[model samples]
Target: MQFDRDRFRFGIEAEYLLADKATFRPLWHNDVTFAELHNLMEAIPFDDLPSMDGLELEPPHRKLMPYVVEGYHVPNPDFSPIDILPKGVEIRTPVCSSIGECLECLKTLHDRLEAALSGSGYTLVSLSHHPTEHHFEGPQNKRRYDFWQWAMEVMTTCGPDINVSLPRELNDPIDVADLHRKVNYYSPALAALSLASPIYRGKLWKIRGTVGKSIRTYRRSVIAPAIELHPEENGRMEFKLFEATNRLEDYHAFFLLWLTLLLDEGLKGRSRDQSRIYDLGAVARFGLEAETVRERAGEVFAQAPVVLNRHGFDAGPLNIMKKRLETGRLPADDIIDYFDETGSLEDVLKTRTGLIHGTELAQDSSVNAAALSRSRQSMTGI
Candidate 1:
């Protein structure tokens, strides 16, 4: 069950918070906003997708909550306030043959989605949890989310990670259990590389009073070989490690890094000690500043370039990981530092495009940050 680079393709599922620009708090008006979105998407005049990044004519149909069965959903106007996630929309990309194609398609999908959100007052943001907030709203569906709400309430206080999907064709030979083990072993590296959720309920995770700790992704590990790996299911597997990263560089770098590492036999089960599992939690808690995992991540990043270069990726995209190793400055680190300096989350999230602007750390021009259409609509209050 060797990694098949030629046969592999990937997609993205980016979750965003529908936030009130004034208070930096999460908001969701499922009735008006959801209908606006639906009607706008409904008006699009296409049956089948034309291209990965081309104009999409179809939108995911909305379903009532309770999540009784696996299905798609529209907003529930009849319900009261709920956690922004259940009501918030996730911009997903169609499975694409290459990283470039996937990203391009995502850009288009994101653009059209944002266009629909125009005049809606609420804007999309990629915060893991409301920076300084809590949810008192009831579940989206009593039957479906009741169990989830209970578990998240009973088991953990935090929420989901920035999950992505990589496609392996149905015809490809994938040993489910073996592949699952290898993937779970390496999944933590993705979280370490793409850490965007640093603050929760208005303070740094370390100091936040709510949970006594932050880093939502580490609250629990999912049942491995998540969904798409099932024999009868879709031909994709989920990487449930990363928090919400709005950067294209992080998206591209992550999937490519996964591919490279997957192919590198030396990287598989490279850690012999407890650090393999413990360090993922450390990464969630401290980003690249985690002492032990950062060291190991550096070693892996150093080796991945050779493999990435072989696959026609210039390796410049992996610069974020390199920057993290050299300086211990993941994206979350800088964002936190900036917030500490100015006491502004909106400024940091709004102005910073990716982790690659005016960067003195590594000036690799080949390292591309393809955020051509960044939304500058500031979530500010007068």
Candidate 2:
């Protein structure tokens, strides 16, 4: 298959704690700070390979350097990538436009770095989080310092730390509008799926989704239209509704219903069968629920229409019903009644089709359905 640059490009920006050449302990005594580190690294001949921590440091670009520097105050003594730091060490490799290329790059870099570091009696590791190590400072390089300072300022004003990752599936170059939709749709789901940081500062926080909370905070501070909780007077859970709109709307109603049924069955008793059912049910429920509402809305199209309209569009009231059902804002039976009352299913379909296909729907108002649909189809080949 021909490589799809948009879909196939994969890159990894990893941050690893700097460890001592021996005993694999965090290195705390470097005179050159992160800002200085970048400058110094940049000044070093790109062609001149350095043997540090037993790894050979080769610049990715002949004009500049390969290492994208990030610094932390904490000392990570372990070789496990997990124990790196909170705002720990970061390693940014070259941008690979394909997954195969990316994997190859990772392998090559890993091998070279390991060999170079081995000579120095040290190694590098990869992981998401670590529980043991703490205490670190940002890099000293002017650019790195500026970035960390800005990030800290924004985050401090917001709430907490947030981290997120998305599947490689949506990496393809998509229409700007479709990209927006997919980003808006999958962000919440990905946030939910990748929420692994539960215990922070050695305490069990009540937040069920640590990663989501962190991201929510980041979006509020860094991203525009920061998420605000509905006031008690408003009688609304702000985040809840947002999640429903973005992810739930894109999921299949039957799939969601199946999950709900499983959950119900699992919660009925404490038997081993019930426990097993509950586990499966829980995973399904969370997985489906995490999907963005817009994505869910897309999934609704996959279902066979129970009712069709004069235009031959399956835009039955079922779509609306599905939305309400997924959102828990209305009873399933009530949705059916509402669907019966709604006009032509084709009209409804047109409305949804318009919403999805519209260009820059989030940022622009002039986009139309036909344009949006064509753009999406062209990008995804759907």
Output the number of the TM-score-best candidate: 1
Which candidate gets the maximum lDDT versus the true structure? 1
Backbone clash total for model 1 is 11
Could you tell me the C-alpha RMSD of candidate 2 in Å? 20.3
The local distance difference test score of each candidate is 0.49, 0.29
Query: lDDT by residue for model 1 over 50-131, one digit each (tens)?
Result: 2334213332344321111111232356543222223455565555555655555555555555555545555566655545
Judge candidate 1 at residue 33 and give its lDDT: 48
lDDT of 2: 0.29
Where is model 2 more than 4 Å wrong at Cα? 1-10, 19-63, 72-91, 95-97, 118-122, 128-149, 153-178, 195-199, 202-382
Candidate 1: lDDT of 230?
27
Clash totals, every prediction:
11, 47
Report the CA-based lDDT of candidate 1 relative to the real structure: 0.49
